[model samples]
Structure formats: structure tokens, C-alpha cells
Target chain A: MKLRVIGAVAILLSVIIASCQSEEQQEFQRYYNGGKIIYEQRCQNCHSAKGEGLSNLIPPLTDATYLKTNKAALACLVKYGIKETIITINGKSYEGAMPATDLAPVDIAKVLTYVTNSFGNKMGIVTSEQIDKDLLKCK
Target chain B: MKKLTGALFIILLYTACKFNAADTPKLPIYGNRDTASKVVNGKTVIDSVYQTIPSFKFVNQYGDSITNKSLNGYVYVADFFFTTCPSICPIMHRNMLKVYDDYKNVSDFKIISHTIDPKHDSVAVLKKYADKLGISGNSWWLLQGKKEETYQLGEKSYLVAVKEDSGTPGGYVHQGWFVLIDKQKRIRGYYDGTDEKQVDKLRADIKTLLAETNTNIAQ
Candidate 1:
């Protein structure tokens, strides 16, 4: 009888663990979905839903050159502001100023993660740890 | 009846195309500014593209040397950003991604990004940021150098303004305008990288630039 009881307990435990795993997956999806919301509220103004930029003024994050080369710089730009800077994109020169924003680290991570993933930008995840590292530099 | 409808549709399409073509006039390759303005403290009267894009050395995301001389005779799009910007950086980057892909095939054009927060946006950090953005090779550059020089370039050469505001939580504050420089290094146009209408204007300007490259000046 005790052995049978043990088997039943084991099965129950397995079922619970499986449910928990599924729940975790759902939670992650929520976070990703939340990132989309954030993108619409904040990112859509400057970066159109299509990710096409405003002429020669802004560099497109969807391009492989930026996704491949300036991941860290991109992060810093999102966290801090490019107060006075000059950048070249697609064989053009632009001297513009970008100010820092006031989003938290997690929000920054999710938004950046969204940009890194969207617009043909197939790049790795930008974790909160990486955001923290970039934030430290901003300080 | 079906054949008549199809013929009418074709005629309408052709008329629309013709109307659009006629409505769009040939704008200058780079925009023209007729005013004599003071970029700096009542000194250095600016003229044309020849007076802009002066030679200066700065490090790329990979920490390589980049100078105005190095980029001579090339068309490019340049903007400024740091890794930690919270508001428009992501949006600007999203649009920039499109610009990069659209022009990735054009060998004569390149992309440049300047770090406004130089003290914090170092080469190593910029490299990591570039990596996250999936930027690789020589197609794009994230540059950073002295703060004053960059500010001057933005204010005078590029004709944009910048300043730092520690009172604001972000430590540094600045404008969000993007300047378009021509092959001859002249300030051709200014666009709101954060605005959609302005971006469309930029796209049209780029198309104009490409078309004008093959045409000779009509003196």
C-alpha cells in the first residue's frame, strides 16, 4: 500500500511541475507581448512600424551593419543620450543630437530586445544584465 | 461589361501614375538654405558643402580610425545616440534599420553613428552595443571622441545644437534632429528622425541624391 501511495505522489508531483513549466512559458510570452506594447507607445513615433527611418537623419537598426557592429553602442544610446554626436550610416554623414531617456533597466531591456529582434534585425537577446552593464557606464 | 471595367481600371491606374509623376518636381539634390547664419559666436560665415565635413579623426565601434578625409566622395547617413537612451533611441534605431537595408547594396553610401555621451560611450562599450544591434564589418561605424569637438560639429559644421543637462535625470540633454550631409560634405537637409513624415522626406531626398550623382552640374 505504501509503495502504491508513493507512485501516486510521484505522478502528482510530475503533473504539478509540468503545469509550472507551462506557466513560466506563458509568463515569458507576456513579457514579450508587453514589449510590443511599449514599442507602440514609445518607439513608433520615431521608428515607424515598418522600421523605415526619416531620410538620412536616422540610422536603421534593422540593418545588419548596426545589429552586427554597434550592439553595445545601441544599448548605451537607449539608456543614456547621445547629447552631441556624429554618426555615419549607409555612406552618409549625420550630425545630430539625441537626449537620454528615463526608462528603467527592465523596460530598456525589453524595448531594446524588441528592436534587436524586429525589422530584419536577427540579433541575440539583450538581457537585463547587459542593460545593467551599459547603465553602469552611463553613470 | 467585364472587359470594359478592366479597361477603365487600367486607364485610371495610368492616369494616377502620370499624375504623381507630374506632381513631383525635381528638388535639389541637397536642400538649399539662403540665409547667412552664425553657427558659432559671430564668426565663421558658412557657405556650402565645400566648407563642411572638415577632416577630423575619431574611433569607430571597433576602435579604428575614421576621419572626414577617409569618407570623402562618399554618400552616407549619420546620426547620434548612446547605448542607454530611453526615449527615442529605439525608435530611431528601428527606422535606421530600414535605411541600412535599403541602402546596403549601394557601395557608395555608408552609415555613421556618433555617441553623444563620450565619457560613458567608449569604444569597447560601443562595440558591444554594435554587436547587440547586429552591426558587423565596415558598412557602419559608431564613433566617439572629445565632447567639445562633437558638440561643435553638431552645432557649427552639422548645424545642430547640443548641450548637457545634469538636472535632468539622464545626466546629458540634447536635441533630436538628424542632419543630412551630401557627398561634398554640405549640410543639405535636416529631418526629424523621430517623425514619420520627415522620414518619408528623407527617403525622397535619398532617391534624388542617387539620381543626381550621374548628372553634371548645369552651369
Candidate 2:
């Protein structure tokens, strides 16, 4: 009887874990879809649909190292334009300045999350709170 | 009733043939038209003679003067944009770059990028901008000329619109058109430089123009 009770507990725990994972997956999908729409409307013209960017004129966001290391700067850059600085990604330098996007904090977060997690990246999601904090620190 | 049906069918066939003949694509020769008298089948007929693009001079990114003389016997594409443009210029630049790449190896084909903001985009600035875009050699030229002359060329030569506006982001407004000029310096086609599909059409039309040039030379 004790073994049967333990087995029931194991089944319940597995079911809860599965549901939790699915819920997380669903939330990620929501962020990704919303972020894709925003990116297509605003960012795709310069950065391209896959974030591959134009040749030497714009920097590619596909580099996982760049995206992971510059998470805060990415959020800030989205809110405010990066002027007077040349950004280098994966040893290739881009000279053009990134224009500031007039996106809200929530939308900025979604775009950041979408880019970071896309184009062969798995850097995870960026929250609106993070974007708000980053924007506060933008120069 | 049968005879009426036969007559209607004959009329429809004639109309369709006439329409198909009219639909044949022909390059328009722009500018002032002049009438020339011709005797055809013992009858006097008047035909219109079309003019070509007028001669002008502008300084290229290298600070060298480029004139209509330099563009003689060549097919070219021309457009207007400024470097610091915050909006449509980049899209146009990207599209123009695609056209440049496609025709870079072709002889006697050129791309002229004239800056509407000539004051800010001097020879030095245009040179730097061209360098940043990796545009080297003579296939493409970044031109900076007098504001009045550039504006006039935009309206008169390329048949594009340009003006200044304080409320606009770039402080100036211009159309995003790549005007295709044939070897005779006549405007052949205009493509929206910001649209990829239009740029594709521009590429295809370039091929057609080149074929037409070849056929003329052969003749």
C-alpha cells in the first residue's frame, strides 16, 4: 500500500512538472510572436528579417556572444540611438550608427527577447522591467 | 443572323490584333518633341522627334568633375539621397547596392548617387560614406553638387521630386526613385528604390536595355 501511494505521488509530480514546462513554453511563444511583429514593423528594414543585417553598414545580431554579453546595452540601444561609437561584432566592425527606436518599454523588451533568442541564439527572454532599468542608464 | 455573327467575330479579331500591336513595349524618348515631315507611299506624313537628357556637370566623391560627356554611350541609373537621412535613404541605399552589385562587372553601366543635401554632404563626406559602403572603383559615383543645380536636375533631368521641409526628419524631402537612362541619355524607366520588387524589375529592365543597346550596335 505504501509503494502504491509513492507511485501515485510520483505520477502527480510528473504531471505537474509537465504542465509547468508547457505553460512556460506557451509564455515564451507569446513573447516571441509579439516580438516578431514589432521587429518586422520597425527593425527589419535595417537589420533584415533574420537579423543578418546589411553588409558592413549594419551589425548582425546573430552573434550569441555579442547578444549575451551586451544584454543591457542592447536594451539601452533599442531605446536610444548609438551615436559616435563603432560597434564590432565577431571581429567585423560596422560604422553606421543605430537609429533610436521609439518603442515603449514593453515592446522594446519583446524585441530584445526576440532577437536574443533568435538567429541561432538561446539567450532567453528580456523583461520590460529590465528594459526600464536599462533605459534609465542609457547615456 | 449567321452573317451578323461572322461580321462581329471579324471585328473583334481586328480590334484584338490592333490592341496587341499597341501593347508592344517601346522606350520613350523624353524632352521637347519636334515634327519631321516624311513622304510615305507618295503621301506627306509628320513624325515627332524626341530629345534626350541635357548636358550638365557635377563633382564626384573623388572631387573630379563628371559631365554628360563622361556618360556618353553608357546606360546609367541615378538617384538622390543624403547620408544622415534617418528614414527612407537607408532602404534606398540597400536596394541601390543590390543593383550596383548586379551590374558591377558590366562595362559602360554606371550608378550615380547624387546627394540632395550638398551642403552637408561634401566631397569628403560623400567619400567617407562611399568607403563605408565598400563602394570603390568607377562603376558607382557619389556626387555632391550645388543645391540649386541638384534640385533642378531632380526635377528636370531625372523627373523626380525634391523640396525642403522643416517638419520632416531629414529637413529635406525627395522621391526614392532610381531613374534608368539609356545610352542616348534619355530617361527609360523609374523604379522605387525602397521596394525590393521594384528593384527586381529595375534589374530585369536593365538587362532589357542592355539587350536593346547590343541590338542597336549590331545593326
Candidate 3:
């Protein structure tokens, strides 16, 4: 009877843990789906559907190292365009200007979350607060 | 035995239909908006010769004057874009680069990029823009001409739309079509410049046109 009671408690704990993980996953999914719609409308024209950018013209977002290194600049890039700048990714150079988008802070966060977490990346979610803070520090 | 034979017959018929569907029809050659007749051994043959691009003058990236005659006997792709466009021009420009890379080796193949906003994209600006994009030589010519003439060519010759709109993100608006012109200066195909898959199809069709031209020369 003692062993039976312990097993019941263990099973209950596992169920609770799994439910909590799934809920977090569901929240990420909501952000991802919302971000995808916004990305398709605003970014897909140049970045492409799969984030595989054009040859030497637009830089690819699938590059995990570049995304991680330039995470702060990305928020600014989305809100304010980068002009006359040379972006080097994986030994290749691109010199195209990314025009500024007219998206809100929430939308910018969602888009950042989507791109960072997608295309062979899992960089976690970005909140509106983070985007607001980052935008303030943009050069 | 009869049921097996029926199934086999159905399968054969389905394969036959699939084969037929795979055969693409020859693309139509458009002619000038005029019809003429000729007498071929007393038979009235309607001779509607293929229409060609109208003669026009424009300045290339190197400030060299380029006319329709200069581009004769070459297969070329043409599109219109501006330098500072914040909308679809970037996507179109990227896809055009792909087409350029694919056919850059062919000596007679060229790509023409016309700017509708001539006031901003002058010869110097276009030259600088071309250098920024790492495009050298005459393989890709970024042409800036009179705005009205360029818009006319876009509408009449290329069969694409172009206009200035204030409400759009970019001040100017134009279609995203990459037009394929044959050696004879006739439009052979049109592909969406914003879609990579469609650009791939355009590349394949260019090969088909080149092969067809070779076969004609041999004959």
C-alpha cells in the first residue's frame, strides 16, 4: 500500500509537469502563428518564404550565429531601416538596405520571436517589453 | 480474368491521359495590332508577322546610349524598378539577379533594368547602385530614361503596368513581371519576378528558347 501511494503521487506530478510544458508550448505557438502572418505580409518579399535570402543581395535569417550575435540590432532593423550598411553572413557580404516596417511593438516582438525560433533556430520568444527596450537603444 | 483486364485497361487509359497532359502547347507569338494578307499561289494567306519591341533610346549604367538596334540578335530579360523603392522592387531585383547569374555565361544574353523614377535614379546613382550590388560589365544594364518613355514602354511594349501612387509604401508602383525577349526582339515569356519558383520556370523556358533558336539555325 505504501508503494502504491508513492506511484500515484509520481504519476500525478508527471501529469502536472507535462500539462505545464504543453501550455507554454501552446503560448509559443500563438506567438509563432501571429508572427508568421505578419512576416508573410511584410518581410517575405525579400527574405523569401523559407528565410533563404537572395544571392549576395539579402542576408538569410536562417543563420543562427548571425541572429544570436545581432539579436539587439534586429529589433531596430525591423522598426527602422538599415541603409548603406554591409552585412556579412557566413563569409559572404550583402549591401542591400532593409526598409523600415510600420509594425507596432507587439507585432515586432512577435515577428522577432517567429524568425528567431524558426528556420533551424530555437532562440526562444521575444516579448514586447524586450522590443521596446531594444528599440530605445537603436542607433 | 475479365475484372483484371478492365483494371489494366483503366490504368493504360489514365497513363495515356497523363502523357497527353504533359505535352505543353507552343507559346503564341503576338503580332502588331494589324492583319495583312498575302497571295501564295492564288491562296489568300493571312500573314500576321510577329510584333517586335519598338525603337527607343535610354542611357545605360556607363552613360552609354542603348537603343533597340544595339540589343538586336540577343535574348534578353527586362523589368522596371527604382532604387529607393520600399515595396516589391527589392524582391523583383533579387529574382532578376538570379536570372542574370543563370545566363551570365551566355554571351548574347542580357538583362535590362529600367528605372521609372528617373529624377532620383540618374546615371551616377544607377552606376553606384550597380556597384553596390556587385554588378559589373554590360551583362546587367541599369537604364534610366525619361519617365514617360519608360512608362510607355512598360505599358505598350512589355504589357506591364506602371504608375505613381502616393498611398503605397513606395511612391511609385509597377508590376513584378520579368519579361523574356527572344533574339528576334519578340516577347517569349513572362514570369513573376517576386516568386522564385516562377523565376525557375523562366530560366527553363529561356533554355528552351535557346535550343529552339539553335535548331532553327541548323535547319
Candidate 4:
């Protein structure tokens, strides 16, 4: 199909383009790009494109302090979803249930990296290995 | 002599533009219509009647009874949604808030959202949801009533689809259409509630309808 050919060319072009960059930079680029698509598809509806969240309903993801403090638990929150609990974000308490996703650990890391990095909070790339460790500690 | 004719031509062009500007764009009336021939003043006359939003009764978020008669004079937008909808309802309302903010102060404009899942989304639940979504006043009313009546009104009158589906995320399926009804209770347009662009178009069309009615009353 035409779509398959275009996709193949895009992948090949990316590989050639990424050859110039270091391994670490390439890894981050891959995760960041992949995470952007995932975030737009899954989280953009509620959190909004800018992660500003719905007013008094869904909590914003722009709280850098909250993301930093709960860095380890982010994976669990994305994977298992949030229950009926009020959490304070940016000085506002939001109560609602977030539907759990069936995404794998790597997806969790990719999306987390995208969320943290783009939304005025830069915490670097969260790897699948780190996500595996965090999932074990989910409570 | 040529200069005088040029000045006259300029005046003619100005009048032409003015005439065109005076004629405002109008929204097309949507829905089925029928014509009946009758004798008036000993002459046979044909009159066309457009389909309108039929009579229905439901309770708003404030527990006040809302009938089609309640919205008789006001131009209103109608849509079907539930509180705990996980898929499209959030985005639909988010986009709708833009329209709400634009016309909240306008007395003749209103928005009514009927709930398809009346059993779970009771009067109290709709109230809470409205509160959380920053909705207040009579401008926007979230109505809840018998499930069958609500679904029938949405599908039959508003021309939007509504059904109960357990396999879906929210356990119900419905189109995210913001149906615009004129002061005469006829549908003017339908906009995809989930898309910001379409919602923007809906607001523009609302202004057109309002202007059309305002001029009619002024004349």
C-alpha cells in the first residue's frame, strides 16, 4: 500500500537522520516522539493539549512539584488509573476516576517522558527498566 | 461631462454595495416539511409547515420541570450526554463551554443537554456534574428523565443518534451533535460537538439566527 511505502521511507529516513546523533540522544528522541503521539491520542481529551486540565474537573499535569515528588508512582497511575480520590494539583483539589489503560511499561515510560518534558517540567527520559521497578512499588 | 458620469457611476457602485450589505446571511431551515392547500379569501392557498421539536417533559439540574414550551421563545442548542461518559463527552462539553461563555448573558439564548442514562445520572448527579464543570444559571440546563423518552427525543426530534451499548467505554453510545433550534423550534443546523472548528461554526450560525429574529421583531 501507499501508506506502507511512506511509512517505510519515514522509518528509513529517521534511522539515517538519527545516525548522526549519539545513542542517548537517539533513545530520547525515539521515546519523546512516540510519547507525543500517545499523549495526544489518550490524555489530550481530558488534560487538554496544553495539559491545563478541565476547570475544577480534571487535574492539570503542569504541576512540576507534584510530578517530581510522585515520579515513581506516575507509571502506576497511568497503568492502573486513579480511583475516587481527591488530589491537589496546582493548589486545586480534583476528584474523579481516570480509566486505566492496557499500555505496556515501555508505553508508560514514553508517555511519562513526553508529559514531564513538554508541560513545563523537564525530568529527562523515563526508561522501561525504571518503569518496571516503579510498577513493583505501586501501592 | 465624463467626470460627472464617473461620479454617478461611483455613487451607483456605493449603493449596490450598501444594498448587498443590508441583506444579512440566513441559516437554512432543516427537517421534513409538508404543504397543505386551503381556501383563503375565495382563493386556494398552499401553506408549508416545517417539522419542529415536539413536546417533552424533563427535569433540569435544578429539579425544575423543563418542557419544550419552556424553551418556546428562546433559541436553544440540544445535545445528549451522561455525566460519567469516558470517551467523547468530556471534549464535547469542553468545546461547548466556549459557546456557553459566549451566550450565557443573552436571555433569548439557552443550551439544554438531555441525559440518556437517567437511572444513574439523577437530578443530584447532574447538579454535581454541572457544578464541577462551572455551569450555573438558567442559560444551560442538564435535563434528566425517563430513559426511553430521552433517547426518543434525541434520535427522533434532534436527529442525533442515542442508544445503550454495554460494550462501549461509557456503557452507552451517542453522537456528539449540538443541534441548533430556532425560535420557531425548527432545527437550523447540527455541529459536531467534539470538534472545535464545528463548534465555532455553530456559534457563528447562532448569531445569524439571532440577527434574523431580532430584525423580524424590530420590523
TM-score of each: 0.52, 0.81, 0.79, 0.87
Point out where model 3 deviates above 4 Å: A1-22, A55-57, A62-66, A83-97, B1-25, B38-45
| Per-residue error (Å), model 3, residue B152 | 0.7
- Per-prediction DockQ: 0.12, 0.41, 0.29, 0.56
What is the fnat of model 1 with respect to the true interface contacts?
Answer: 0.21
RMSD of 2: 6.4
Error of 1 at A44 (Å): 6.7
Across A74-126, the per-residue lDDT of candidate 2 in tens digits comes to 87788787885888899997776777878999999888888988889987777
Encode model 2's per-residue lDDT on B100-179: one tens digit a residue.
99999999799998898988999998998888787899999998888998898889777789988888876988889999
Output the worst ten-in-a-row residue range by lDDT, candidate 4 chain B: B20-29
Tell me how far candidate 1 lies from the true structure as C-alpha RMSD in angstroms: 14.8
Please name the candidate that would achieve the greatest DockQ relative to the true structure. 4
Q: Write the per-residue lDDT of candidate 1 for residues B94-176, one digit (tens) a residue.
A: 65666677777777777887888999899988887776565677777888999888878776666666678777535656655
TM-score-wise, the better of 1 and 2 is 2
Residue range A18-128, candidate 3, lDDT tens digits = 878876688778888899999989988778878987556678998999999999888999999888798888888877678887999999999998999989989988888
Interface RMSD for all numbered candidates: 8.5, 1.8, 2.6, 1.0
Q: Could you give the CAPRI-style class of model 3? A: acceptable
Writing each residue's lDDT as its tens digit, candidate 4 over A43-139 gives 9988888998777888889999999999999999999999988998778888889999999999999999999998798999999999999999988
Instruction: Please give the CA lDDT of all the candidate structures.
Output: 0.70, 0.85, 0.85, 0.91
Tens-digit lDDT string for candidate 3 (B1-219):
999999999999999988875543244455355668999999999975667799999999899999998898788889999987767877887777777888888887899999999999999989978876778888899998999999999999988999899878778778888998888888888889888799999888888878766666677
What TM-score should be assigned to candidate 4?
A: 0.87
